[model samples]
Target chain A: MNIEIKDLRFTYPTGLEALKGISLSVNAGEQVAIVGQNGAGKTTLVRHFNGLLRPSAGSVWIGDWDTSKYSVAKLASRVGYVFQNPDEQLFSRDVLTEVAFGPKNLGYEKDKVDALVKRALSLTELNDQTETNPYDLSPTWRKMVALASIIAMDTPIVIFDEPTTGQDAVNVARIANVIAELKKEGKTVITITHDIDFCAENFERVIALSKGEVLLDGPAREVLGQEEILAQTYVDPPQLTRLGKMLGLKATVINQEEFLNALK
Target chain B: MAFVNFQNVTYKYPLTKTPVLKNINLQVNEGEFIAVMGPNGAGKSTLCYALAGFVPHFFKGEISGEIEVDGKKSSESTLDEWVLNVGLAFQNPFNQISGAKYTVFEEIAFGLENIGVPRNEMKDRVDEAMALTGIRDLADRSPYSLSGGQQQRVALTSILVMRPRLLVLDEPTSQMDPIGTREVFGVVRKMAEEGMTVVMVEHKVEWIAHFADRVIALNEGQVLMEGKPNEVLTADLLPEKGFGISRYTSVARQAQQQGLWKQKQLPVTLFEAAEGFTSKGGGGSN
Candidate 1:
């Protein structure tokens, strides 16, 4: 399903304009990343897809459905949101129950729910901890549990908010694999990240937001190469990309292979 | 004796059978900046709590061996007395906020006020600390109203004002942007230069390579490797152990294997990587 936003504007109850006159679209199965400083309105903009926060002006459409007109639960079948803080979303006694909660809530048949939960648990490597209470797990493990819950829901459009925060390298690699798997299944993946390297490695499209407006949006190669513009939003290009620039490499490189190829 | 020493230290949380930190032996000289890197469940945060005197002191469990700071053993000092000279800022910035204070400035000053520092001296210290973290403009804002990055800065400022002999930070800049992260690293590096011992648990490999004096790699409740930042961060063992190393290191390693990289040592920073891949006459291509 495609996501279309037209001049979307949002204001908090406290009178802060979180997003202003933003317009963009993600075609079906496109992998996109959003990067910016803390108050750059990344979260506020993505929250529109699930109808968590309605736009103050303008419109948001997920597929043919107007997001503002659909209930969050109704939209859950299409959009799976993985929050930054796992603590905010996790409330189940055990990992199995937690992973099952999403698909079951969507009213999937028991057989399908079990299969989805099993796949999610395996992908997140939570099979061993299925009997363990989520709270009993470390913050790192809890993050995986939260991810598993959303994966079990199996939405066509998935949004990950700072998925790498507080995760170790191993868990980060695990999460990246899950994302790759999602892309293989032709799911549209949108991530808001501070880890530029992770974004560069995973997403093809990059969107930079600054002070409630889009600063730069294009292919990761072109957009991330604009170091000065990304700096305006307090972001930096991936390490390999920066190194390529410093070495006077003609091509913009975002990953190790491209960088090695450039060096050659 | 070293300023901070851990001798055969092993600890288990209450009701937990296996020890989170096991048989650790370490030493840190005064003013040294040490960065700890490890996978999850590797006991990095537990090490921070132990350094800040939280392990056996607050989170009591089966513990042995001495945790000594500044020639004083942890067993001999109360948690209150220990924290006075060994300030700590951990993973959750939200928990560090003192709810009694209405503004960021007052919240930072709350620690000094409790110790009865004169009002004038307290104000100066709070202002200076906030300036160090570049959060001086947030002085009047409520702590709860700030963004996560802002809150992290406030938390760090709150601890820096105490001017402890030993500083323990657990992923203090986890939520910060690239610029915010650089600023915080600069502040901590400055603090170390002024003769403060810092033990930080951080995952950003490039910053650790640039600023930290030493690197300690932990895995499964033990010290897997310890050395200078360049050595530890570029070591093949780090990647095998599931530790996140710099992309520069990863790239350079692959390049070296293919005989494309000429440098004997892998690069942990972008500058080093650029220099390594560049030819002798200032060009960087095959």
Candidate 2:
């Protein structure tokens, strides 16, 4: 299963162009990250994947399902989108009910919905919070509830919009692990983020958008290695990458472990 | 007098019988840049609200001890008056913006105009605020149309136009990218340099460690530690206090363990760390 986008162009109702001629594809089970600065059309491009927004020009095809013709409800079964703010998406009284909302709306039986909710809660490490109110939990735990809601839907392609925003190191590492586990389960993962270190360490391919155009798209290591290109796009390279370049190192080092080994 | 003072203060939410803040004592000198850091539920936000006179003024709470801002007791001051003297930007930008029909210029000018500043003075102050926040070109744009980062700048500019003596920002850059974060910090640094005090509750240690003059760490609704940035951000103290130490600090500590660099003080910024490593004549790929 592959996702293909060709010559995509999206204009808001106010006649502002958000995405201009975006074209790309994600092979099945590949983890890809779309990175860009603020107002760079990264969110506009991903919202089109799940039929939330229709392109004024061009088309989006998720394994032969034309996104332009599909409704959000129809496409949601194939692609799950986790929004940036979990408060906007999670509204149920408890974590369990929130996770079960999607499966129940999709017409799953009670037993199946219960099992799916359980699986999602366990996968997101929120099983203990199943009985707790989402509003009472911390921001990180609320985010996990949002992820569990999507995972219960069992969409093969999961699109996360800035999953690590405002998260501390422990939560960020947990999210990275969740993405890695999703990849291991043969699910396609697409993330739109501004955390360059998260992109460099976890994603295999990085697609950078700047001013409604694709600036760079390739292997994450190679794309992140180009400090000049990143700076031109108004994106800061990871601190490790900057230190590596300043020291005249040959390869890009993203994490402290790699940076320390490089020094040795 | 110090701009802000808290002496052995304690507070508890109405619903919870337990105090959220316990025996807190701190002072903020005028024109200083202070960063407050802690894990979730650490009473950081509670401290900001308390300073802004929101604890007993807005929320029902039990309080003890004293808090004075600019030499006035918080209990005696009204919210409106204290809000003007000490502007606060919330963690979520969407909650702070007001007047749906207002443009960026009008939003920034609203506060000054409300205070009965002269018409001509309003324009100058608004323009100065916009320029300081790097949002001068966005004056004509609608506040709702801006991105998260741009909206945050608009919020800051709106407060800046009021010329508050102290600015309290609760996680202003939490939702921004690295570039956007730098832009927000740049404005903060400029404000502090121009003799305005800034108190920010932040989680991104690495980004602010280079800029902050002081660090105040909180845990479980109490002050865990407080000192200069270098004095607080260390291996022995940060992890135990539940504060996220910068990756650079972690790496520098490991390098010390491996006998690579032997500086007594840890470098907080990328530039400083690079210079420290290079000056020692050790561990750089040629």
Candidate 3:
């Protein structure tokens, strides 16, 4: 589903104004990454997408449905939120049960739920660990279980929070592949991440936030190219981008192939 | 003599069949900054716990080895006494915050209080620590109210205020943004420069390369490799052994295969990679 966020402003109960009238839109099936330093309001902005947080001064529309009008549970049918810390959400005894929880809570038929859970488990490469306790797995694998739990919901829009935070290279590749699969299914995928390289590789569009304001927003290459502006948010451009700049290359580079091409 | 020594160290939790750390032997000189790296379950955290005197003492684990820090044997000293010489700040700063404190200032001073530092000296030490970590402004804020990155700074500052001879950090910036990461590393580097030995477990290879004097790679609780940051990080076996090498290093490795990069040594940081690629070199398309 498409997302339309207009002039959004949010303030915590302690009177911290997190979002300072930010605005953006995302088309259906578009993969978008929201990036900024810690406490840059990336989490605050995306929480509005699934009705977890309401706009104090503006509006967020997921398709035609206004976020303010729906409860988080109501929005769950359309927006699947995978929290940053898996320990915060995981409650099931085993991986299969954890993966099935979302769909089951949404009241899907048992057969459908089973299929969805199995599909998610396989996608996350957790099929062998279906009977294993999630708590017994490593934190990296727990993160995958969390992702699989949300993907089982099969929502039109999925939001992942810092998917690569503590993951290794292999796990990171798994997460990237999951996003690619979601995009193939015409699902809108939005992620809040600190891994700029991962963002540069997987996402086409990027929205950079600074103090709850939209500091920069555009295709990943264009937005990441603004190194100085990004540095203001305490973000470095993708490694290849920085490498290209440091090399004084004529073209903007965001990946290895481009860096090699620039060398030629 | 080494400032920190671990000889034939092997440890297992209460019920675990396999030791988390296996036959690990390492030595760190005084004031040397060392970074440890490994995949999940590689015993990186276990190593940190062992150094910080938490393994056999706190966890009640079966540990067999000799661990010595600053002339004091870990097996011989009490946890309280060991902590006075070696301070540890780990991942998940939220858990590190003492729940009894209201303000960040009080939270930092709590450590000194528990260790029985005089009241008058506590204030100066806390002030100096906060300044060193750049958290002076957060002194009055509630420790619980701060963000993860801010809380991490508080945790680090709390440990740093103790002025322990050796500091052990476990992914102190795992939850931090890039800026927070840099700031924390700055404090760590400064501490090492000021003659405080440090052993850190971290995944951010670039930052480790920038600050660490030595790098130790661990796999399945064994020391896989140890050397200069560039040497170990750019080692060909790192990826195969499930170590997380920097992206720049990997990219340069790929370029080498295509005859696009001429450097004999792969770059671990962006600046090094840039300099190598841009330098007037041989055996490359450029």
Candidate 4:
């Protein structure tokens, strides 16, 4: 299902305007990455998709359902929002229970919930830790469990908040693969992230936000390849892009692997 | 004398029988930038806490052998005294800060004020600390209002204002984005340049290798190797230590695989790697 936002404006209880007159649309099965500096209203914008935050003005529509009219629990089945801190989202003792929470809440039968939990656990590669207490696991494992929980909910629109924050290269690669799988399963993936390398590698389109406005939106390579625009958004473009600009090479190389291949 | 010393130290948790750190003897001189790197649960954070005198003080455990900071035995000193000599920043920034209503300025001043620094000297010290961490503008802002990067800076400035002789940071940039990571490391490198001893437990070896005076690798609670960045970041050794080499370093390795760059030295940064590639003219599209 496609998502449409029309003139969305949000103001906090303290009279602070977080998002102002924003409008955008994300198509079905489109992998779009939202890039911005700190306090750029990235989080505020994504929260609207899942009805976690109702806009003060304008409207957010997921297909025919108006997000403002739907309850969080009702919207959650259609839009899965995974928070940045897994500790904030995961409260169950074991991975199985954590994954099952979402499916059960969606009114799935007990047998179906159990099957969905098992499937989600296997997808996140946490099958071996099904019985382990979440607190006893590492931060990365906890994050995977959180992702499994959302997967068990089986939302068509999945949003990830900085999924690669503290991950190492291997774990990052694993998350990237998971994202790829999400795309293969015909899910619309919207990610708020600052890992420019990961964005350049995995995402096809990019939207750059600054001071509660959409500054740029285009192909990930074009958006992230511009050093001045990236610097303006408080983003450090991938190193290879900098190297490319410094050497007067074509402004297309974004990673070392691509740079090496281009050199060849 | 070394500012911090761990001599054949071994430690185990209360209920667990296995040792978390084993036969580790290391010395950190005053005003040095040292990075401790390893995979998950490699006892790096354990070493940081032990050096900060948290093993027996904050955590219940059995520790053997000697660990000292500034010639004072770690077990003998109180946490308050340890705070004076060595300031520690945890991997999670949320757990480090205190005072819900405290602004960034007030948070930094809390430690200095507790130590009974003169009221007249507090403002200047706080300003300097804020300036050092590039959070001077954030002094008036609430700690909760800042971004992850800005919040981490506030936490760092709070520790830096204490002017501890040694600073122990556990993955200070783990919770930050790429730009934020660069900013934090820039502050850390500047601190080391200004003659502050910095021991960081980090996983991003590429960023650390550029500024670290020494690199120590740990595995399963034991020191696997310790040396210069080039010596420790070698392709043959890093993979064995369970570290995925930096992409720049990996590219250089692949170039060597294809008989391009003939140099044996590993390039840790994009600048260095690019220079190496260009100077060799072996794979320079430019």
Q: Stretches of candidate 1 above 4 Å error? A: B99-102, B281-283
* Per-residue accuracy of model 1 over B1-286 as CA lDDT, tens digit each: 8999999999999978899999999999999999998999999999999999998889999899989999999999999999998999979788778889899999999999989999999999999998889888889888987777888999999999999999999999998899999998999999999999999999999999999999999999999999999989999998898999899888878887878877778889888888877856332553
On DockQ, the candidate that comes out on top is 1
lDDT of 3 at A190: 95
Cα lDDT of all candidates, in order? Answer: 0.91, 0.84, 0.90, 0.83
Candidate 4 per-residue lDDT, tens place, B37-112, comes to 8876788888898878887678879999898888899877788888788988877677788865458899889888
lDDT of 3: 0.90
Q: Where does model 2 sit among the CAPRI classes? A: medium
Q: Give every collision pair in model 1.
A: none
Total clashes for model 2? 0
Clashes per model (N, Cα, C within 3 A): 0, 0, 0, 0
TM-score of 3: 0.96
Candidates ranked, most accurate by DockQ first: 1, 2, 3, 4
Chain B TM-score for each model? 0.97, 0.92, 0.97, 0.93
Checking candidate 2 for backbone clashes, the offending pairs are none
Error of 4 at A256 (Å): 4.5
Q: In model 2 chain B, which range of ten residues has the least summed lDDT?
A: B277-286
Better model by TM-score, 2 or 4?
A: 2
TM-scores of the models, in the order given: 0.96, 0.95, 0.96, 0.94
lDDT-wise, the better of 3 and 4 is 3
Model 3 regions lying over 4 Å from their true place: B282-286
Error of 4 at B162 (Å): 1.5
List of clashing residue pairs for candidate 3: none
